[model samples]
Target: MGNIYAGVDLGGTTVKLGLLTDEASLIRKWEIPTRKDDGGKQVIPDIAASIKKNMEEEGIRFSELAGAGLGVPGPIRQDGYLEVCVNIGPGMRDMNPVKDLSGLLGGIPVKGGNDANVAALGEMWQGGGKGYRDVVAVTLGTGVGGGVILDGHIVAGSKGMGGEIGHMVMDWDWKEAEVCNCGNRGCLEQIASATGIARHARIFMRESDRPSVLRDLQRVTARDVFDAAKAGDGLAEDVADYCMMYLARAMAYVSQVVDPEIFVIGGGVSRAGQYLLDLIKEHYDPLIKLTRGKAKLALARLGNDAGIYGAAKMVIDEREK
Candidate 1:
């Protein structure tokens, strides 16, 4: 039998796992509840047990496995050590996940990376950025998250905080912006994320007496705003334009650094589809004066599965080397 690779995407609520062939084709995939009791100490052991059980069920042997890769939610050191994974648990702070996981799997080589970075890798491998090695992936969910890929490898940076595009300060004036989850005001996450969209919608509705279809709904959501804009609601369109402008400006700043060939937009809000891409491009094009061409923008294809695919690809790439 050909060699297979294991991938794990560890989240606070669940741990997603996948088995893939050497070519990065997934053979099977599954998940397990994350036991975060005891400060996430059981997370690694549980992952190890799940992989072993699945391998047994499939009649696969350890010798035929390339190794395992993990996508963690927090910052990771260059040496595969975690600085602190707040979502996982308190015990995960300052621990070497790669070393611990490798030991648990009987010395099987294990690699770990920030979940966003790993997801970016997944997109480059099989999703929107498939043809491009240098790419930037931006996730516009409740909060913003990003990953930077340079020369087909993740730019983890010195503190594994590379590709943290969401936290970029966009507005310095606190009076006009709300504080972000990071305890900062005017972060890109505060203006460009799904939550930010909803927040902007509320502000627009309150500040203006302009008629908006969005006013009919008791609760306003990012989707509601986008749908209303598509229906020609003037206020909704303004809100959408505002959100995209900030996002575009952020990408323009990023271009000065890595200048990726493409920007893959993912996460819940990206479901807005082509309209969102068009809106972003319309705003982004004018901001870049020196770059030869405007950066390409595309929606992420893998959805939630990007992390697992990228995780498996991590191990596969290592084995190939």
Candidate 2:
């Protein structure tokens, strides 16, 4: 047994905590409901308490920990300050998570980072990006999220918005494009996200007489479109192709800049699996002119646990430093 480390994935609904050895072996993992009372002021304290409780039960002590790391939904500055976490609450805005959590844990060293970026690190450390140093991770869920890892370190950029692949503009004209939550028009998130896939299906069904089983359902999802497309539904097929095409375009654009060795796709929409990868490659292969077919794509191996793993990796890396 080696020194234990703690990792926290703080979300709007739940806080996932994991205890891992210095060797990156997960010893225990658990979750607790996020109490948003008092503007999320209790989140850090609650996490510390949970870790202490669990360590006590496991016959471990705080002194035995190498360090701790926290992953937040919002951007995290280089100094471990959370610029703003809208999903958590207003109180967490402009707070130093590293200091707050460390204070609660008796001055133990703590690290903080953007949740999506940390998830990418987790993938690189033990998931799909394993055995590779330079990697790009794309998460397709309700909205698109991405993280860039080069030389086994996260590229959070100056303001912690480096790997925001979702905001990449796909349509410069804004023609037939919907406004993204980021106030941008024709962002990759507008067309390639899960919500975007379903929206495309709805629009296709409305514009054309092409029949699809999606028409029978009250609501269509990205999964429904993939399933219908696999079953030879022309309408759903079009929708799937459109979404994957845009996603590939985004990846193609990223490849030109970062030139990652591999792309690890994750999140709910990625459940489409090899079918989704094939669709992406079908379009991706044509767009690359220089580094053609160099970047390989793979599915993310660590589902929801990527964040915690990445967080723990942050601590482990810091100890090495």
Candidate 3:
């Protein structure tokens, strides 16, 4: 029964809104499709409307909210401005999310951050790293995104551009990766992302003599590869193995660099379950030279609610400090 707070996770395709108590307890949550075609301009107004509707129907007062914590795809500038969002189109490049949304959201203070960082904070504060201080959270989706929690605080670099692990180089051989949407080439994102997994499977299907059950499906997905691997199909196994190896190598790489107490994996492809985690452990076990047994990888516990929880957490932690 404390002051209510709001957390919004804005993606290219959807916007997830959560209402929470100051204690991070979930009150009510909802999601709506994001209209990316109109550019970043449209999302703010839609969010404002949603908040207004919720106030009328749910009896939540806007003034009771301490602030709103927001998560958006792409790099965020320090003032909660959008620096780049490939999935949402180029219009977000110079968009000021805090300025726009605050105007629409009824003068509530807004703390903006990169989606991955928010998700990481979500996990750290109430999900996987609840009792821990140091952790690294990664989302394996259409593209890879990462967040680093160091010494109990979210690590936002000078301009809020910190903790972008997907851009880390995993393959020097690919040499100047294929120019990612972020304008970087040869990023681990091109290999470890969900889309990357599907892309890899597509190429394997074309060249490999290995037969796949996915051949008949209109589109082969990371899930299809997992299903195929379960069915004993070699092509599926190959794709799974390749993705796992890349993930494992990446985990090993992170272990060497961050040496966090845990590595939490979430996102669409993460549902692949043990097939993915086991592979990461398999590689992480042998290659990591930092310590004999200091780090462990765990699945993210919050699911989709982490963002809202993390958002509310921002207020609670800030007050404590």
Candidate 4:
């Protein structure tokens, strides 16, 4: 056999792993529970054990493996170290996972990157943005996440904050804006994320006695609002429009800076499908008049698997060099 690569998408609840050939063909993929106890100290060991076990089952020796790459949830310093992964555990703060994980895995080459950034790279490499070198990936999950790829490389920035499109300020005056987890008010994430979408729906229902199908549900989800809007609920439509407006505005700002060829929309809320893309483009087109029709907007193809593909791609690229 030639060489194999391992990709690891390390999330707060689960650690997703993928074994891929040097040619980027994924042979096997699996997941393991993320043990957050002991400040996430067991996470690395568990990941190492899992990779080894899987390799053994495949009858591939460790020597045939090329390298491993990890996608972390928190900010990654330029030195291949994570500043602090709050969702994973407190003990993982300022940890050098790239170096430690490599040691555990018998010193095979290793690389690491931010989860969102790696996801963007994945989409650019083998997913929605496959043909595009300059791409921006936006994930509308519980909170908004983003990754920027310029010339087929991740722009992680000095502090790994380059592609932080979610935290982009949307509400300048903080008027009618709630505080974000980043301790800011008016972030795009506060209005465009799934949590933000649901929050807006609740606010609309509470502020206006608008007869919305969403009013029937005790808990309003982003999907509920989208479904209601699609079902012709005026109130839900307005709420959804409000959310997309902020996302479009943020995209316009991003366009002025990087001018990516396409924007890949991902995450749970993206399940809203083309309707969501239409809403964003409807609002987005008017904002960036000069760059009209230049940047195409589409949905992400890989879904949750994008991260592992991206993580593996990182190692593959290194090996190729």
What C-alpha lDDT do the candidate models reach, one value each?
0.90, 0.90, 0.78, 0.90
TM-score of 3: 0.88
Query: What lDDT tens digits, residue by residue, belong to model 3 across residues 1-321?
Result: 237777889887899988877767788899988877666567778887886687657787667766777888877876777767777876677788877877787676777878788889899888877777888998888788888888877777877777888887677777432677766666778877888888788888887766678888899888888888878888888888877787777777777777789888998888877777776787668887656785778888888887777766765565456
On the 0 to 100 scale, the lDDT of residue 233 in model 2 is 91
In model 3, what lDDT does residue 188 have?
A: 75
TM-score of 2: 0.97
**Worst ten in a row by lDDT for model 1:** 173-182
lDDT tens digits by residue: candidate 4, 145-253? 9999999888888988989999999989987656788998999999999999999888888898868789889899999999999999999999999999989999999
Where does candidate 3 stray beyond 4 Å?
A: 35-38, 89-91, 103-107, 175-178, 215-218
Off by over 4 Å in 1: none
TM-scores for all candidates: the values are: 0.97, 0.97, 0.88, 0.97
Model 3 has an lDDT value of 0.78
Candidate 1, residue 26: CA error in Å?
A: 0.6
Ranking by lDDT: 4, 2, 1, 3
C-alpha positional error of residue 257 in candidate 3 after TM-score superposition, expressed in Å:
2.5
**Local error of candidate 3 at residue 112 (angstroms):** 0.9
Summarize candidate 1's per-residue lDDT along 259-318 as a digit string, tens digits.
999999999999999999999999998989995687899999999889999988887787
Steric overlap count per candidate: 0, 0, 2, 0
Model 2 C-alpha RMSD to native? 1.4
